[model samples]
Target: MATIFKTDAGNYKALVRKSGWPTTTKTFRTSRDAKDWARRIEDEMVRGVYIQRSGAERMTLEMALKRYLTEISPTKKPTTQRAEATKAQQLISHLGKYSMAALSAELIASYRDKRLASVTSRGKTTSNNTVRLELALLSHLFTVAIQEWGLGLSFNPVLNIRKPSAGQGRDRRLSAEEERCLLKAVNDHSNPMLGWIVRIALETGMRSSEITSLRRHQVDMKKRVARLSDTKNDSARTVPLSKWATETFEAALNNPIRPIDCDLVFFGEPGKDGKRRAYNFNKTWGVLKKKLGMADLRFHDLRHEAVSRLVEGGLSDQEVSAISGHKSMQMLKRYTHLRAEDLVGKLDMLTREH
Candidate 1:
């Protein structure tokens, strides 16, 4: 039985047939629309096509997380699944008792205010961006559940939330003097690999992961090439080695640690595994740059420096892309920031044309 009523706000409503789940109700802008909704509800019940609505609408955030962990998280990769678990934990711990269906613009706004005001595990004040990322992560999980898991959620309240913009990208590069200083000052005690890492990074524009994971067998000293097997984006590329890079290979090979590990190129520590010892290089890099008062520089900027040099060496976009493994010209353009001073000869051609 369907009972029709008019709301105090003048919206028409209908109480559709009570099913096994909570009594299904339909609200409509018009009486005819309400009647149509009631008819559809009854038809779904009769046909046995109506699945039970998620108890999530009636349950807390914690309840949803427990369900996801036991029922779904097992199917994902370990790292990815762990990240999802962490996101769920954050939500459960913070908004544990909050019902998903009851989430509104104002409630989310209040949550953002609380998260931003709270201190993080790092004991630092939480920024708007941090809060925004957490909220966005939660929003994405809801989307995944509704779309991927067939949760049948009709509304996503997160759609109303605003995201904070990631601030300006760091434009860091080693100046000529700073580069010389870094090369000259590096020693075994103070990041012996930094000078070599810096140079190879500048020469090849290979990602840090690719360079750190390079093996002795992958290098062809005579051919001056290193074959990287399936790097980021599952890309297999051969980086042409410069003369300095070839010599660096020889030096590493001559060292007693080279071939004993079979294919491991850069060992983490003397006896440790090469694969496990892959360096992030930030700590040593920070100290070295601080010594020279160039603390603003980042180690990854070496790749940018390498690309800049490649552009200056008169390599076209295609040529540079092949060596550096850049997928598109637009990506390469970001690193090709040449100053007017560096374009002296090119500007002379413009004067001649004028």
Candidate 2:
């Protein structure tokens, strides 16, 4: 049964109640519109297809994203939380006005195309992986809204939309000559710690955050291992340190630039309130890359180089994965780029056996 009444604000409010269905309500400017909505809802209820979509219809994308940021993002890793927060902001800017119920597969596909064609402030086009990640965040939000938040969405719009192809993983390993030049440039840099950071990265296939956030207590110089309690995969891992890595930490310990306030292995200067923070060398890294004329190289590529070297040195996939902190074999394979020249000797041995 449905009931219609004129509100004090001169709008008609319709309320529908059924035995098994949740009570549904909607407000309309005219009595006819309210009655029409009630009839449609009643028909759907009788057909057993009625889903309470009032929450989705009433809540805009902006509101849902804001709620997700507050309620969900905080529970994620710091790096993931920061990245998702940025994605949420971008989503709010693009399609925030539409209510969740109004966001269809077509609308999501349109947003995807628009984002793919968009350029960043740095004058570079957005990568497919970046757009893919944004879409993933939106997909997760819809899933949460439907499952947990009682939004009553029949389907995730993002699921039906075509996502940008992530393409192949980067295989930008440093050449022997390029590596020498890069190391020389790093050594010439004003900050002595910068060179050691680069050296450690090449020696051990650790992510930038994992290397930077390393605590003094986590490193066991005698054992030549660094135990990370918090990794991107939320799994604690112990990475074996190379002789060069151990030496670099030893030098950093004696360096005056290393802060005293924090136990951070690579600590930065004190802030306005005298609180030490993690060392940030992004600017210096950029300058060094430009000076070396390797603008295409990323700091992360050093990890790729390390992984490739490990594979070339005949380390098993399992051994390399343990050192690199890669949780999945598929992910570890992406980082491993073997050189054709390095395979020639193995190919020759096979010929001899034949």
Candidate 3:
């Protein structure tokens, strides 16, 4: 049974008390509304499908995102943590005022459409992949709220919405003349670390984060292997160093000006907090590329160039993935863009052998 009575403030209040269930109360502007709400609650209770939505109604998206950043983001990798924090800000700015209960699939779909239509700070339209990743973060937060945080959400709104397509992978390969100019410019820069980092990427096909976050002890010159324990995929791998790569490592290791307190292979200047972090050469790299007339060439393309070279050198697909730390053959194939000029040499050799 339920009680619907007029309140002292000229509003109607509905109260429901049932056996084997917690008491629930809600204030409504009209007596009819109060009775209607009470009847729904009673019907749901009888059907054994009642769920208290008070918590979801009170908790806003802003509050949930902050909690997630504090409790969940720290458990991810440093790169992932940073990326999630940025994505959280974007979500918070747009949909933070909406309570969890108020966020419907239609509302989330509107956000998706708006984000796809908006331009980024970089003066380009936001990519579909960027929107997809943002939605993915939102979806995960809702899942965590339901399963772990006990927020009592009936279903994830984000799951009900369509995600943007994952755009095509970049097939940007460096040309020979461009590579020569890039190397010369980096080698001649005031900061020698920039040159060594570029050479290492070209030689070992290591990710920028992997190459920059290296410690001296991780590299073994005698074994000619650079051991990576904190990789992007959370799988440890040992990258075999080429003769050229070994020489570059030796030079960087034996740098006379290197601070004794810094253990990072590529150490930057001390920060305001007096911490010597990894070398941040993004600004420098950007300037160098612009000067060399290769403004479109990205640093990751260097890794692609190296992987393609490995494949062209007669290394098997498995062999290339092992070196590049790629988890799947499909992903490895995306990076291996073989040049037509290189294939012509193979064709000529086949004719001679026959």
Candidate 4:
């Protein structure tokens, strides 16, 4: 039932009371408007489609993102948590003042466009993947708010919005010439560990983080296997070492310059506090890339190169996925691209057999 009253301020106030639902009240200039609002609200309640959006209307996107970071981000892996926190900060800077109730698909689309057009300090436009990741974070935030936090959002605005295409996954594999150039550059660098790291990544398909964070105890020289206790997927797996990788590890273990404080296989000299930290090769890698004229090459591409080699070696997808630590076969396929020239040999072999 709805009750309409003439308030002292000469406004018509309408109130709708239902047994199972919260009471909804609104003020309008005319009784017709008040009645219409009451009728629409009651009808929605009866159809079980009405969501109480008071909390969403009260809380801004900034507050919700902050709360999510504190409550949920810690549960994720450290690398993932850092990236999510950075995205959350970007969203807060753009849409922070907007209430959850005020966020619409139009607004989210507009934000997407804005981010796509924005350039970084390096003068490069933000990649489509970056925009897509931002939307994913925003979508998850709405989901948590609606399902767990009870923020009263009816739907995720990001769901209704179109996301920028992530574009094709990078299929950039190093040429033999490029590999020779890179190896020479790295070997001539000041740090001896840089060449070793590059070799391990190319041979074992290990991520840079995994190689850098490897502990001495995790290496089994007898078995020629390295045990990874903490991986990106949060699952433990063993990576077989190549003959070269095993030899490098053996030499590194026997190196007199190895740090004693840190258990990490690749660590820097002790600071004033006498604590050794994981070696950071960002500056060194950059300088080497410039020197080799391979500025576009990324360290992660080594993993791609390794996976592609495994695929070209006639390994099944399942076998390659095990070495690459890819949880999904689809993801493993993305990294296992074979060059057209390499495939030519297989095609010729098939023709000869025929």
Candidate 5:
């Protein structure tokens, strides 16, 4: 049974009390609205399909995001934590005021459309990949709320909305001239760490973060291997060091200027917390690239170049994946952009042998 009462503010309040269900109440603007809500609750109770939605109605998106950042973000990698925090701010700016119960698929779809059409502070149009990552974070938040926090969401609205397409992977390959210029610039820089880092990336397909965050003990010069326990995909891998990579690592590890207190291979200046973190050469990298007239070249392209060279050197896919730490063959293929000029030499050798 349900009861409708008139509030002092001229609104109608509906309260439902069933034999086997918890008491629920809601306020509506009109008596008709209250009556309709009360009837629905009672019918659901009778059908044993009633869910207590008061928690969802009271909690706003901003509140949920705050909780998620505090509790969930810390469990992720440092790079992921920073990225998610940025994405959370964007989501909060647009839809934070809405309660979880009020977020419908249509509303989320509108957000998606608006984000797709928006521009960033850099005056560039937002990429589909960026929007997709933001939506993925939101979807995961909703899932966590329902499954872990016991929020009374019937279904994830984000799941019902269409995700933006994952845009094409970058196929930028470093040319021989560009590589020569880049190496000369890095080697001539005041810091030799930058040069060693660049050489290691070219010789081994290691990510910038992975290269910068390496500790002395993780590298074994005798075994010619670098053990990576903290990777992007949460999988541990041991990377075989090429002769060039091994020499670079040896130079970097034996750096006379290295601080005794710092365990990082590429140590930055002490932060405000008085702790040395991974080397942050983003600004330096940007300046160097602009100076060399290769302003569009990205550091990650060095890894791509290395991966492509490995394939061209006649390493099998399985062998390359082991060294590159790529879990998927498809993703590994994306990193390989073979140059026709380089392949011509191999073709001539094959013809001579035949």
Candidate 6:
């Protein structure tokens, strides 16, 4: 309900009231002007029309971000937390100062354009991949903000914004000789543990993250299986531990670092806080690859080698899929390459049998 009042002091004024929102009042120079503006605004409200909200409000971008940050504190996965936090920081930098209701279709389009125009990591224009990643994070956050939090049910403007294409999956792989060379090099290195990491990568087609997060209790020598939970897809899986893998576990049991707590099988060097932490040897790996003139091969290529070898060993697609814990044949197919030599070998074997 609203009321129009005329003041003898020489000003015409009006008052507006709405449920769940504060009342607003304005003063106008003439009674005619006040009536016209009041009627127009009231009529729009009666018709359920949206008026763009501005200023620091409950649904402002900054408030939503603070809510998001406060909610993710219970998680302990450092890598996952770091990545998500970095993404949130990017969103705050991009849209934190704006009112949630004011993010219209046209303005979102403009923001997308500005983000895609140039990538400035350290104030210099960089690659398209950087922009693509940041935009993906933006879209994901807005999706959560609108759909999950119900910040503005009627006003999700991100859908109209076009997304840039994310490129193909990585295809870097190691041939048989290269795998042999890598194994030999790792074995001869000053770090004895490097060889174990390399061997485990070849034995289990697990990602580097999964391998690094391995715990002693996860390994079962009796059943010859390793239990892994919280993998890439957040799915739990049990994979076989080969004879050599079992022996590796036995070797680890002999060396105990700081009375093992919980299920941690492997721990990194102590941090400044004096707590043993799990570390990634990516830099050392990079240096080793560079020395061998095989720096082009990525750590993930080790998983590819494991898959390729399983195929070469005459394991059926299903057999390899079970060990690799791949949910779909599509993901498995990317690592499987057709070898002309394999076909030639089959032909030669046929001739010999005949």
- Clashes per candidate (backbone, < 3 Å): 0, 0, 0, 0, 0, 1
* Model 3 lDDT tens row, 1-354: 899999899999999999988899999999999999999999999999998877788899999999999999999987899999999998989999999989999989999999999999999998999899999999999999898887778999998888997777888988778888888999999999999999999999999999999999999999999999989999999999999999999999998889988899999999999999999999999988988888999999999999999999999999999999999999998889999988998899999999
For candidate 1, list the clashing residue pairs, or say none: none
Superior by lDDT: candidate 2 or candidate 4 = 2
Better structure of 1 and 6 per lDDT: 1
CA RMSD of each candidate after superposition: 7.1, 2.0, 1.9, 2.6, 1.7, 5.0
Off by over 4 Å in 6: 3-15, 18-63, 72-77, 109-133, 147-150, 256-263, 311-321, 334-354
Model 1 spans with C-alpha error above 4 angstroms: 1-55, 58-97, 104-136, 155-161, 187-191, 270-276, 279-281
Ranking by TM-score: 5, 3, 2, 4, 6, 1
Best by TM-score: 5
Worst 10 residues of 4 by lDDT: 253-262
TM-score of predicted model 6? 0.75
Question: lDDT of candidate 5 vs native?
Answer: 0.93
lDDT of 2 at 225: 90
TM-score of each: 0.69, 0.93, 0.94, 0.90, 0.95, 0.75
C-alpha positional error of residue 276 in candidate 5 after TM-score superposition, expressed in Å: 2.4
lDDT value for candidate 4?
0.89
- Of candidate 3, the 10-residue stretch with the lowest lDDT total is 166-175
Which wins on lDDT, candidate 2 or candidate 5? Answer: 5
TM-score of 5: 0.95
Q: What is the alpha-carbon lDDT for the whole of candidate 2?
A: 0.90
Quick one: how many clashes does candidate 2 have? Answer: 0
Name the candidate, 1 or 2, with the larger TM-score value: 2
Estimate the overall C-alpha local distance difference test score of candidate 3.
Answer: 0.93
- Candidate 1 lDDT over residue span 140-239, tens digit each: 7577667766555666777887665555444576678877777786644454565666668877887787888877788888889999984765678888
